[model samples]
Target: MKRTEAEQFTRRLTHHGEGPVWLGHHGLAVLDMLAGDVVLIDDSGAETRREHLGAVVAALRPRRDGGFVAGLERGFCLLNDRFTVTETVTCWTSPDVRMNEGACDPQGRFWCGSMAYDLTPGAGALWHLDPTGAAVQAIAGIGCSNGLAWTRDGTRGYYVDSLTGRVDILELRPDGAIANRRPFVDVTGEGFPDGIAVDQADGVWLAMFGSGLLLHFDRTGRRDAEIAVPVRQVTACTFAGPDYSELYITTSRYGLTDPEAAAGAVFRARPDVGGFAPYAFSG
Candidate 1:
């Protein structure tokens, strides 16, 4: 099949918009990392400034009660329709930790990982938040945790450890616990794995940050396809649109020069693969 042209979906924002997730028919939720804000963008590409969330807002996942949970550098916050921080969960006992990427499981548990802002090794950990807002550390001893997704069957979880250049898959038990950790994919050379999404066929879509590319992988950890993007820092992606065929990607210009400002834009394309039904909060 002929590859489709990548379409520019959204213009550049003053601060970089990193993490993006689909919120059903509502719109796309984006995190303005540098300005510490959360903005909701509708299908018309108009950004509705929601609230000022301190630190960098890295990722967002919809909640059960019509609100959403946003992952910030220091911790996480809960936002309602009015976009206020109604609840907050601090991830670190020390002051050096910062949260990165996050997603929800089929059972409505919010899973997020944290790392040192400076990319220090062994300075990150993953945590799981139950429906009741109680948080627990699920895994530790990691570097730069980002991009998390689960298999369609809900028996496995996939995640990216960006600094280590590896994606790991874990066996998830019935009680929302994970085990049998192993490397699922290793990205070599330039780019680091940033965000991930699992399709209906159990294929994993990975955004290679700083490389301007999106990668597709089958369940057995084999590269199925790759799509290139104009933006160098492809931060994250999610399946949107009515049929979930539209793949919307978020990019950043955090370390780029002035000439690269336009590089911090969102892009979209429709691949041959279809996405799975996004996990919803059931609390």
Candidate 2:
């Protein structure tokens, strides 16, 4: 496999940096997850703004109409273009679990998974929120639910329940429901899979937490390339730049007593292929 190193894009900016989304001219948006902050960075790797939503901001995706849809600590919220919270919905009353990671489908539906704060097994679930402001439990019995991505066509989805140590493939129905699911990649001994992004060429770039590496898997699940990051807690990644050729990565300083200077910093790499823009939530 071809190997490369990602260059540091900025100084350590987050304690537990996660979800990364590339917004064309608007630059990049990432989360200081545990801090409940939405961080906006310019194309030049400069932090331009930071907006706190609640006790935790797990994930976020742009909206088709405008603004954004985000997964908060125990529920979901909508934000206007100005980063102001417009509405909020509590999915459940359970205070033990929190939203973790998610992505919007091509059909404008936002899907996010949850996990227990203490990492309790099977204490979380996958949720679906349609454009009409309706929330439904898509899947239950999940543990450490993380990384989610869908194919451009919306027919397939790649998901990670980190505790499984594998990435699973989901057969998505026309209505944004999962028709079937099966294992797609087994990273059993490599490291824990955290976040993922799919390229236009059907390549899945997965961030391996604690391994300091990003593994690229082709359409057939064959390892093709590797991007080495400076921090061990590599969290998430996304395609950015005008043409979406730039791969932006996020790292974390969580659970580290003495982390590297670059921990919690963002990094960038030039992959062979670009990626599609993030699917916006129709609502």
Candidate 3:
């Protein structure tokens, strides 16, 4: 039953800020999802950089080789040192579906999920892109594929298919493949779970879109606390800041009617535990 409030960290910088990641030495990066923009915000919150990638850019993460791997509209792409895309791989030819949210596993493979732009049921799926540039469909018939994260030990994973109204737990095999899947938490009556972050303690911090709350579930999946963000369309979150003690949240102005000034802004709050830096894409 613990509760806390998040403070605004930036102005209304994105129309639909979806994925937020902390790139250790590179600062914070969040995607303006439907706008195809990759935004970089300095630590001081005094500077911001926007780079347009395509018609839509869903998610992004740093690369181990000094660049980045991003989920573009239909597939994925590799960015160079300057953050310019050097290669693109299209996994599907469907103009109706697009990549959504994702994260890198401990083994350095990037996993992103997709959803039909029209929100058609069972038209989306989860995809995994290994370090060798090959891709595979990990889960099919996904309604709204979103939020993916792994535990510090890489033994477990948390995945969200918004349409299911639940977060599913995953058992990761030694080769990084999924061994099993089951329900971890059912959020049917609450708002949709958009994004999540797993702390070093294996706790899951989830952003409940439209609920304006970031829920904290302990290792056993019991709800322990809720962090309130000022904006209602809270989309995603990640642990950042110096010691990874700060939780950074992204909000969306996508469907709001005359949304408030902070609707599309990013927010931050310090939680009780710390989180590990996002895994870098090895490919």
* Candidate number of the best TM-score: 2
The TM-score of predicted model 1 comes to: 0.93
Clashing pairs in 1: none
Model 3 clashing residue pairs (backbone)? none
TM-scores for candidates 1 onward, in order: 0.93, 0.98, 0.98
Compose the digit string of candidate 2's lDDT tens values, residues 1-283.
Answer: 8999999998888999999997655679889999999998997789998999989998999998788999998878999988899999899888899999999988888899999999999999999889999998989999999999988777689999999999999887887778999999999989999999999977799999999999999989999999999889998999887788899999999989999999999999999988988999999
By TM-score, how accurate is candidate 2? 0.98
Model 3 vs. true fold: TM:
0.98
lDDT-wise, the better of 2 and 3 is: 2
Off by over 4 Å in 1: 1-5, 258-261
Model 3 alpha-carbon drift over 4 Å, by segment: none
Q: What lDDT would candidate 3 get against the real structure?
A: 0.90
**Weakest 10 consecutive residues of candidate 2 by summed lDDT:** 21-30
Cα lDDT of all candidates, in order? 0.79, 0.92, 0.90
Give the distance in Å from residue 271's predicted Cα in candidate 3 to where it truly belongs. Answer: 0.4
Error of 2 at 132 (Å): 0.8
